[model samples]
Structures are given as C-alpha cells and as structure tokens.
Target chain A: DAGVTQSPTHLIKTRGQHVTLRCSPISGHKSVSWYQQVLGQGPQFIFQYYEKEERGRGNFPDRFSARQFPNYSSELNVNALLLGDSALYLCASSLERDTEAFFGQGTRLTVV
Target chain B: SQELEQSPQSLIVQEGKNLTINCTSSKTLYGLYWYKQKYGEGLIFLMMLQKGGEEKSHEKITAKLDEKKQQSSLHITASQPSHAGIYLCGADLGGSSNTGKLIFGQGTTLQVKP
Candidate 1:
C-alpha cells in the first residue's frame, strides 16, 4: 500500500502571494496533520484534523490554515507569504488521533 | 509547554562502532517515539515506547524509555553507512484531545565513516 502522498513535490511563490499544498493520506487512515520544517530544524506542528473536523492547531500565524476532506485528504494553505515562509511542508496520517503517524515526502516551498 | 532536548547534537562514528543518543524531556512523556530522517526526506518511524523502563530493538538499533526519569535513548550497534541520518525523538503530551501533537527535539545527526 502507498504511504502518505504529497504534491506538488516542489513549489515557488512570490511574497504576498498564496499557495496551497495537498496531501492524500493512506487508505484506512482517519487523521491528518500538517507540519513545517525549516532547514536545520525539526518540524513544527501546524494543524491536525480528524473526521473532517479541526482537532488542534499549533502556534502558527493566522495566515496558515488547513482542512481535511471526508476522504481524509488534507490541504495546507498559506496566505500573504513572506520570505520566512520558505520551508518544507510535511503531511502525516494515522489511523486515529494519538497513534503513530506516517509522513509523506513533503512539499518544498520557496517564497522569494 | 513541553520541550525535548537531545544530547550530542551530532556525531561521527566509524563503521562497526557503537554509539548512543539521548533525549530528555522537560515534562512527563505519555509516549516516546523515535524517527529517522535522511536529508530532503520525511521522517521514518523507528519505534515507540509507552511504559516506564520499556526497551525495544530492531535489527541493530535499540531504544529505551525511562518514564520515571522522563528520558529516552537510542543506540545503534555495528553501525553502517546506511545508519547515517538524523535521529529525532518526539513526545506526546497527552492532552484532552487526541490531536497527536508531538514535541520533538532538535535532532541528532549521525555520520558513519567507512
């Protein structure tokens, strides 16, 4: 079975622009979460959704948001992107909350 | 807020040598997880420990959880080139919700010298 899949694998956007990254969870998974990983740093939590409802959010700016679909696919949206927004966006999926999460290859976003 | 601190941020070891990395948490850990990530790749889950003094081993890798001390350690024996990567330890705070919010350490980068 395929693991969590994310696309497009790479992206580039200009400052003040918006970008949407997508993720398709593994089959039979019911939870999806988003994380941002800057170079030389561990990933920081962004948002987590279960059963198509927002379950938790991290200490990110209001410009960052995400939602999970009925099929358990998720999309991460960043508005008013800044140079600091350039980083790797990772998506994870699990059978349920608090379980082991499997990650996708991640989308590398570059804002200039 | 909970935080995880990993010791020996990076290490270089010769092939066939053994090395260990430690992860200390500021607060009690309901569950501890170990993951390995190669450069430009997503994290790969290694193991998870939930009980105090629990230890698990996979092939040449071993991980231990000391719940009483809020500490965990990962050890690799007879390391090989394939063992070179970033090892990260994550903690579950176990909040009212099951969001699976994980607090991770800075990570330990390992280099295996051939």
Candidate 2:
C-alpha cells in the first residue's frame, strides 16, 4: 500500500503570508499528525487529529492549525508566517490514535 | 529543557564496526520510537518499544527500552554505509490516550565509511 503522501514537496512564502500543506494518510489509517523540523533539529509536534477530531496540540502558536477529513487526509495551515516559520513540515499517519506512525516526505517551507 | 535527549549528536565509524546510540527521557515514556531519515526525506520507521525492558531487533539493528522506561538505546552491529543517516528517537509521554503526538530528540547523525 502507498505510504503517507504530502503535497507541494516544497514551498516558498514571504513574511505575513499564509500557506497550507496537505497530507493524505495511508489507506485504512484514521490518525494524522503534523510536525515541524528545523534544520539540524528533530521534529516537534504540532497537531494531531484522530477520526476527524482534534486529539492533541503542541506548543505551536495560534498561527498554526490543522484538521483531518473524514477520509483521514489532513491540512496544516500557518498564518502570518514569519521567517522563523521556515522548516520541514511533516505529516504522519497511523492505524489509530496511538499506534506506530509513518511519515511523509514533508513540505519544505521557506519564509523570507 | 528538552524532554528527550539523544547522545552523540553525530557519529562516524568504519564499516563493520559496532556502535550504539541512546535516548533519555525526562518524563515517563508511554512509547519510544526510533526512525531514520536521509537528508530532505521522510522518516523511515525502525522500531517502537512500549513495555519496559523490551528489546527488539531487525537484521543488524537492535533497540532496547530500559526497565525504567525512561531510557532507550539503539545498537548497530557490523554497521554498513547504508546505516548512515539521521537517527531520531521520538517519545510519547501523554500516556495511553496519546494521539500520536511525539516529542523527538535532536537526532544523532551517523556517518559510516566503507
């Protein structure tokens, strides 16, 4: 089966702009989570949705939000982006809320 | 302070050598996961350990979760150049109800020389 897939493998945005990243989970998966990885650092949790509902959120600012669809696809949106927002946005999916997750190639976002 | 800490920010070893990487958590870990990532690529899941003192292996890679559940280690026997990548350890500290939100450590980058 195909693994988690993310869209727009890369993106470039300006400060104060908004961007949306998309993710399609593996078939039969019901959980999708978002993470941001800065250069040379590991990923940091952003948001997690299970069965189309928000289950957990990390320490990210209000500018970051995400939602899962009935089909288990997800979108992560960041508003009023700042240069600091530049990073690799990764989407991960699992069979359930707490199971092992597989990640996507990630959307590389660069804000200037 | 970082919730998860990984030792040896980077490693370089000759092929056929054995090396170990560690992940320590300040809080009790509900689940510990190991993943590998090449530059500009997605993470490749290696192993997951939930039970304390649990140990699992795949080929030449072995992962162990300490009895205390707060420490984990990954050992590679007869390392090969294919093992070169960023090794990351992710921890779930939200208990049983966690929804897959993971706190990851600063990855340990490994470089294997042939």
Instruction: Residues A1-112, candidate 1: write the lDDT tens digits.
Output: 9999999999999999999999999999999989899988888889989899998899999999888888889999999999999999999888988688888999999999
Best by TM-score: 2
Residue B76 of model 2 has an lDDT of 100
TM-score of each: 0.96, 0.98
Q: What DockQ, between 0 and 1, does each candidate earn?
A: 0.63, 0.77
Per-residue lDDT of B7-114 in model 2, one digit per residue for the tens?
999999999999999999978989999999999789999999999999999999999999999999999999999999999999888788353799899999999999
Q: Give the worst 10-residue stretch by lDDT in candidate 1 chain B.
A: B92-101
lDDT per residue, candidate 1, B1-114, as tens digits? 328889889999999999999999867888888999998789999998888999999999999988584999999999999999999988776643243578788889999999
Question: Chain B alone, TM-score of each model?
Answer: 0.92, 0.97
- Of candidate 1 chain A, the 10-residue stretch with the lowest lDDT total is A94-103
Per-residue lDDT over A27-99 for candidate 2, one digit per residue giving the tens place of the 0 to 100 score: 9999899999999999999999998999888998999998888888999999999999999999999998778
- Check candidate 2 and list the clashing pairs: none
Stretches of candidate 1 exceeding 4 Å from the true structure: B95-99
TM-score of 1: 0.96
Estimate candidate 2's alpha-carbon lDDT, on a 0 to 1 scale. 0.93
